[model samples]
Target: MSEDDRTRAMRSPGDGRPLPQRPADGLRSGGAPAHRMPGGGPGAPTHQLPNAAPQGPPESGPKPGGSRVYGRERSGSSPIKPLRSRREPSESGPPSPRGPGRRISGRTVLKIVAGVLVVLLVTVVGLFFWVNSRLAGIDGVLADYEGRPADTPGTNWLLVGSDSRKGLTAAQRKKLATGQAAGQRTDSMMLLHIPEGSDKPTLVSLPRDSAVTIPGKGRDKLNSAYALGGPKLLVRTVESVTGVYVDHYMEIGFAGFVDIVDAVGGVEINVRQAVDDPKAGLKLKKGTQVLSGSQALGYVRTRKGGALPDFERTKRQRQFLSAVVKKAASPGVLINPFTAIPLASSATAAVEVDSGTGAFDMLSLGLAMGDSPVTTVVPFGGNEAVPSGGTAVKWDRMKALALFDALKNDKPVPKDVIDAG
Candidate 1:
């Protein structure tokens, strides 16, 4: 070989120069010919076709680090483009606030609480209307008397307890020891007066045997008006005698009274003395005792033996009525729907109210009674035998008038009237 050709063949491949061609036979130490380097050496030109029709896929060949991706060898400049998975994000850092696995905040909890409260309020309101619709309403139970006393300053409610066995079954009658009374009569009567602006409520019990002139039936026992013309005449008679207007009237009968007592479980009362009365089937010992429905019925009905029979009985009726109000308003009954719903149903079904009395009026009466109002029986005067073979009660006229006046004018009842109890 010539000196210059030999020098070219000995040059390193890094010189970016082509190797000198070998002899026709082969390299001196030879086997097969060596492959050409990529990005051809300096002496060899880099061929470029002018505006080549987007060249087809490059030919396959072995690479140094890994298999060739296209025509280019795997290198730092030529990255292996990763194949994307369906679940992986296109570009990533951290998840968004509304994305999966977000934490709950206080505002969210408050919103949830508010939503629940609104739902409960709506439910309670709906339930109230449904229950109010169930009330038993009456018409014209109040008399339309032109001579009726003028309306007074406070609200007046005349509450009556009747001895009516109209709805009692044979078993119930036997259980309650109530003989089958053919007709209804007032066994107990009272007036509850509530003055405006938080004045104390006064509960005045009217004796059934009070000597009063009935509007149509003159000079009869107070209870006789109820038997003759029902509630209208009774209210009329009371109005004429007391000179105090009757704003609302409420009454309950035997079966209904018993059911209400039982529905509230029972009423607790303090009895100062022991009593055993076979006529009313009331057997009780002194001290406080909780009376069941049947026992309580007898307690209010018995008027046999006491200092004054009917007067003492009226006191007991007042006590029991007050206890009933307390029990119906108690937390255990009011907070539990099971107890509250049935008790309200029993009370509304049991009572007969005047035409003007609405559901709200009844509820207001109940709440007022629950306050443990000042309870007193009418001032007693004397007892006289009647032509009808029974005795009539006479009221202490002047004192009674003063008591009614205090109530009519919304004044505190005279201490004398209260002390008389």
Candidate 2:
């Protein structure tokens, strides 16, 4: 084509529109060469070109249509704002409200419960040790002797209540009506037999004034053996007469008896008749009633109720002891910290056990006693006068032997022997 025709084709007809400028690199602003309109004449369709680049070095900014140009801004266009990432919260606005806290998993809850149980177990074990250490022990009280009875099928415990004012003050002694005695004497004695089989335990009361042959001394009142030689001779005398071995020995004095009863919050007893014994400091009406420590001590010590005072007293002793032990071992007291702690402290401190017996043995004793054992006094023939000892009760040899043999063989006592007692 002729140069004049090419030049005319690039320009617009008669209306005089401005011509597009070339960039510094000799190309159009869009980096493409200009193309001519298809029908090269006036009034024909033409391709529109972008505006020329601004003066000065090409702008490091957005182009005319608000499009980003190399991550820069243009003077007459709104700059393209970078997109906000999800991870980056907006700093210009107020803070968002907090949602609910994360929930704890079931596994975490189990772990917390297990931790609490471990703490409770540790605390219980510590308490057991502390209470066990408080039990009072007696040396050689159950020492083996050459002629001591052999081990029987059942466990035997010799429980002794002594008229000892060792720890009582003047006022206490006066209040308890326990005369000032120079030496300790037996107030009550009982043999508790716990069979290995499911049979219930048996508790037999031995009258203090019964005539029995002491080891070295001849025939005398049963309590005379204790006064002659301490617990050793007394154990020997009882064993020789009963022919049943004594496995454990426990003793409590008058003051200790009171403390134990009071510690357990008192014991309930059904009195058979009215009794007012000034000598024993006991006064009560007939019926069921709760007895405090001081009142319990007197109730068990009094020999003033039935025709046979000593027998009635023994019955009273057994009744009161069983009630108190049951209460002490009951869940209502054991599960309660207030009652359990004081009962443990007072009972352990007050009672004295043989060297071989531990806190567990004592606990077993309480549990066995609380089982409502068959209670009865030793079978007695009648009262008798001895040469050295004053008037004393005599045991019926035949019935007594049957009862002890039953205990030795771990068999139930003969019904006739139980009835005789």
Candidate 3:
């Protein structure tokens, strides 16, 4: 088409219409594109463009159509900002109420501690009552005796290890080498004297074969009194001989002794010399060794192959007794209910105490013995054949009296007396 014709066609339509003004910069004031209707380019009728977005100041909050304008205007294309997991506030602003975290209170902590202590207290008390209930009570065993010596300054207990096979079966008797002795006999006897003050407790071993006058049987082996009249006659004879009051009598038998040793796992003893005695079923090397129930019984009972049979036997008895007391009081036994409960049950069942010896008395005696006692045998003059044909132990009169006097008055025995026995 000719230039004059094209120009006339493009310009002739809006030659008389007013055009809208544009901004100096390309960007619109509100950061949105300035828009207009499709056919109203030059405002041919001067009507506002239909469906046009608002063009307000860039600092205004938001567009009227719910769209946001960022702080700085974009140059070309819009790039997306990564979303944060949580919104961050101004640097100097207060913390959010839901952000600080939880804390435990002092009152809750105290309640927890109190609950723990109450549980422990109940456990301990229940154990105490359970142990108390297991103690066996012996009554009327000493009631028949009369004219006993009056109470002395300190306590004296007659602790006897008897050779009574009351609970032993034939197999057990053979295993223990405890011969089939028809009746109960005192295998070991000890005068355990606990002095009134801080002086150490003294344990004096009395030979079962000691020649002593039985209350009505005249002179005989000391053990005969128990065989004849039981605990009463035995206590009477002991009181008359020592001149020390026998306040309590506690006797343990063969089977029970073994049970106790086993229940506590075993007793540890230091043997000075190698011992191999078939009669007592003991075969041990000389050293610090742990003896089981059967082995411990044999260790305490063996008298064979010794130059001084009864004397050496009594010494072994004292050593074994001390070992037993120490083992029983140890944490391995006392703290473990598996051991302590069975031990207490077996011991109480096998032991026979005097009528007056209560659970408290037994407890005191056991505790006292837990402390190492000074062990000695009664001073012996000689071991010779008696009129009855068996050997009988003869006590040194002067030394024996001195020992008894010291024990009765709660005084220390002379070194000579302690050394002589």
* Best candidate (score: lDDT): 2
- Residues 100-146 of candidate 3 have per-residue lDDT tens digits of 63455799899999998998788757766665566554666555456
Ranking by TM-score: 3, 2, 1
Q: What is the lDDT of residue 397 in candidate 2?
A: 91
Candidate 1 local lDDT, 299-342, one digit each (tens): 88888668788888888899999898888878898767788878
* Candidate closer to the true structure by TM-score (higher is better), 1 or 2: 2
Weakest lDDT window of 10 consecutive positions for candidate 3? 41-50
TM-score on alpha carbons, each prediction: 0.73, 0.74, 0.74
For candidate 2, the per-residue lDDT at 243 reads 95
How does residue 333 of candidate 3 score in lDDT? 83
- Sort order, lDDT high to low: 2, 3, 1
Native RMSD of candidate 1 (Å): 11.6
The candidate, 1 or 3, that scores higher on TM-score is 3
Clashes of each: 0, 2, 0
Off by over 4 Å in 1: 1-109, 112-116
**Candidate 2, backbone clash total:** 2
Question: How far is 205's C-alpha from truth in model 3 (Å)?
Answer: 0.3
lDDT of 2 by residue, 1-421 (tens): 9995676666645675634333323333334443446555543434434654322223354456654545544345655677888656567764444424346779999999999899878877777788678877778877888988898998999999989898899999999999888899899999999999999999999999999889889888999888999887888889999999999999889888888888878888888888899999999999999999999999999999688989888898988888988899888888788888888888887888877887778889989988999988899977888878579999999889999999999999988988888
Alpha-carbon local distance difference test for all models: 0.79, 0.83, 0.80
Model 2 deviation from the true structure expressed as Cα RMSD, one decimal place: 13.2
